[model samples]
Target chain A: MKAVLPDDLCKIFSKAGSSGSWHKYLKVGDWLVLLLSCALVVSSYTLLWRGGVADRAIVKRDGQTIIEISLNSARKTRVEGPLGTTVIEVQPGRARVFSDPGPRQYCVQQGWLTRAGAVAICAPNHITLELNGRGEASYDSLGY
Target chain B: MTPSGIELPITEDDRRIARYTAAAIALTVAEAALPSPLPGIKPGLANIIVLVVLLRYGWRDAAWVSLLRVVAGSLVIGQLFAPGFFLALAGAVSSLAALFLAVQLPRRWFGAVTISLLAAFAHIGGQLLLARLWLVPHDGVFYLAPLFATAALIFGTINGLIAARLIRQVETI
Candidate 1:
């Protein structure tokens, strides 16, 4: 066998060819750690997703006056608007709304917004649904 | 027993692989065993070994050890495909790149501690990017905190010191 040179950095490389201690230490970039964190956050979010829709309804007329109602139970809610009442149901996947007072039932078609910055709004009825899964209020009641 | 009272006996090839694998496994165990300040922030003690890997071994070898560490670490932690595992993987990949560059520089130029610190910073940056992509996209910026930054500095320095010490010891041996 050819003698391994002490300064031969390639010796480290060759060691990896089999399976042995070539070096005493190693350094890896933070990228992998960051990726793992992202994965963890996403997984945690998935679990929170199954907690079901956290029912929150906000009613507004002409975008100025507003009244809000929060459902403690996992039940659906219906809010009365100036023109007519709007039925809002909260489910696991998405939040549904029923009312034809506006040009587009934007709120009705708006799918689930699970995380913090997710918001669904209806123009005509002036209603908004904001889902806060990690909210303090939700935790105080029981859990979100 | 091996000469010089060192444990284990092996040929050149065996010694090389063993050291590499030992470093990887040690890092993985450190990662799992050590506690993070927050669930979001970990000390990343493993990166020290990674730095040593990149400097002593070629990038390809370093990559292999990193891959094994992620897979094995995840499996052991049972957090596979979870956010933590991906975060760790990101750090490893970025640090690997940093080390590849560091290795190119003359060994006598920059000390191992300096390289370790750079690798740690790279790991943090990778994590930030991954957060923006997968997790709270808008709030991803929130992931960067002083606590984590401090942890990186402290742990990075520690790893660097350890690497320097190991290098000296290896020379004497």
Candidate 2:
């Protein structure tokens, strides 16, 4: 059977032919970016590990800690926000915004907060939920 | 190539920018449809177009296409003027800046893969910074950096490979 080629493919193949190799493009900059990215990945993971696991989830509204829930229990709670209501669900070792009043539903889209220092914010509702590790606070007083 | 042989009055550079921007926007819109495991982590396939343009055209053209992709892609995805739009804009600007700097190095030593990695890291860094300052306003947000950086590495390599292949094909054409 004769092979059939798409018109665009045929045109492209006929116009010019592959010449240069990818190796020709490799320069010192490539190694630099690669090394830097690897370093960043390593450092970020180190920071994450040092931060430890979160045992509690803190729910805040308008910059005030409204409620703190333990990760050991599984529960769902609803909180009233400026726009409407936000439903927060706490599962084993994780918490998430099951529902939110924000137009974009960003908090809900955050899916879950499982790691220490992870957060989900519903800015329009002025509600923020954060995971807190059992260890000491990672940051000092704000406004440095 | 257009179906008709007749060439338009638009300059070759203008045509290249339009084509590349369209490709990037299409990728962005398609990516938006898929579900992401995390809020911020994405494959960033659209970056392939930026890398290709940078290699083929130049940094200025690549920057134009990258910026156009962010704005037009956001508008298409119904995210214009939203916090997400600003985050995307920040990422695009920083990524372009990183690519601009990376391109300055002796061309023989680096390829799309390296540029993609740099841009990816810069993109995530910029987004995280903006998120910390404007959105979350908490140090905790930085905790997600590891996951994001790992993702950037993986996706950057994939996008770079694809861009390299596409650039080769385009060169042949």
Candidate 3:
């Protein structure tokens, strides 16, 4: 095997401390502004974003618990069901079935799960997602 | 009764603001031609002029130029009294308020770039608040905050750099 040289590895970090033009433009206070913007972005993602949308989401397969997710972070979670893989996409306060291998694609067409008691059921795949929250909820299933 | 209209006096500041307003309006019209991937995101190139006037002239001149630009720009776009017009108004008012305080900071530490960043963030913040309250009427608007904030950081710094460069060029002349 050929020996890997140290000179090649050092090339990767050559641009690290060149003190690019940004250094010349940003002042002491400008750094504060940048940090403030970052804080605002993080706060928007974490706080009060779910006060009205939802609180949590439960993904189940055939009446068995798969996983429970909080509605506070954006993610694309894949769950293995009977038929195939089902992809669930989540925003800060809402969840949706992004894609699924189900034949009818009913759950995917339901779009975002915003309010409480909203459920997206991929029956063919045996995957069901139920949104539970404190917001205004609509009666979905009938037991009477 | 005499039908002749009474003459009102126009000061040099008025003329200067008129000129700056025209420049800002022209930038807004030109910006409208550019394609935007999102509804609230834009280059906001006119801010360079605002920062320039803020430093070159003073707060009063800059304030006049900014507020007039909003009203006049909307009029030209034919969106007078429309919801979009109010969004622009809120942005202008918030940015102007930010500048009013930013300009008072010690020049030794804070500079044009910082001021520009402050104004841009404030502008988007005001627009977002107003939009959530009146337009979308939902918390979904908060989901877009990060995207808008990132845009503010990028464009604010670029516009600040441009304004700094323009100030140097103009001063040397």
Candidate 4:
């Protein structure tokens, strides 16, 4: 049974019979590439170590001034009203927004913006916060 | 029984095909290892090896080596059925087709690098077409600039030089 596949079709399945061999010459350029890949992987992991998101807040219209609720106050402190209940984890320096009335709920799913310069803004309710620092707590108004 | 029906040459042809196949795999692996900032842009380094094969060896050998490269390289990158793998395969096939045509021209006329550039362009064209059909159909044309400037020229030139050098070595052997 001799079935000759077309050249193009055969090419797609020819891996089993064709692997190239190379001499073991340690080129300086190859070494540089190894170092660079390692550096990129290490830097990304270092940036994520020890800290998840620390805190989150939702600002709702309360007549005059904007009111901020601390997400890390207590696990039991749940907010319920006309606006949907947003369960958040407020850490030392970071705040993770759970839900918001926005076009894309992408920000809410990105649990706990813990890294410095991380932010979640709900423009519909005029709520904003700058997530900063590591797991260290900075003094802010935590109570009504 | 197989597509290359000339019952596996046991002499010089076998040696030639084997050598070309090995070189193609090595180059493909190297290209696959490179960091791709975007989905499509590659230095096109493997084209250099393909160019050498096309110039020194016959088109048949070059075609065989190129085919194996796409298959093996895709598996290594863990992108076997992905769009990127098919893009690369199509590009390689198109590039090889271009190179074969270039080789049919007067050998003394076109340089290896010139042929390489043509091949590189063909590969890019294939990717763009696939992107239009499979990916964002509306904005596929937007992919040309960055791919040409950053990926094509940079890797194509590198591959050209490598091909030029290998041709010299193969001649001596």
Q: Per-model C-alpha lDDT, please? A: 0.59, 0.83, 0.80, 0.57
**Per-residue lDDT tens digits of candidate 2, residues A1-144?**
012432322454465554556554444666677677788789889877676667899999999999999999899988888899899999988999999989998889989888777889999999999988866674532332
Q: What is the lDDT of residue A83 in candidate 1?
A: 58
Docking class of 2: acceptable
The ten-residue window of minimal lDDT in model 4 chain B covers B140-149
Regions more than 4 Å wrong, model 1: A1-144, B1-15, B143-145
Q: What lDDT is reached at residue A135 by model 2? A: 69
Flag regions of model 4 displaced more than 4 Å. A1-144, B1-11, B140-146
**lDDT by residue for model 3 over A27-94, one digit each (tens)?**
78777867776787677666644444567888999999888899899988999987889998888888
Measured against the true two-chain complex, the DockQ scores of the candidates, in the order shown, are 0.04, 0.25, 0.19, 0.02
Model 2 Cα lDDT, one tens digit per residue, B12-43: 67766877788789889999999999888999
Q: For model 1, what is the alpha-carbon lDDT of residue A44?
A: 48
Best by TM-score: 3
**Model 2 residue B75 lDDT score:** 96
Tell me the lDDT of model 3 at B159.
92
TM-score values for chain B across all models: 0.80, 0.91, 0.95, 0.81
Q: Which runs in model 3 stand beyond 4 Å of their true positions?
A: A1-23, A35-118, A122-128, A131-144, B1-5
Higher-DockQ candidate among 1 and 3? 3
TM-score of each: 0.50, 0.62, 0.68, 0.49
Candidate 3 reaches a DockQ of: 0.19
Cα displacement (angstroms), candidate 3, residue A1, comes to 69
What proportion of the real contacts between chains A and B does each prediction keep?
A: 0.00, 0.54, 0.43, 0.00
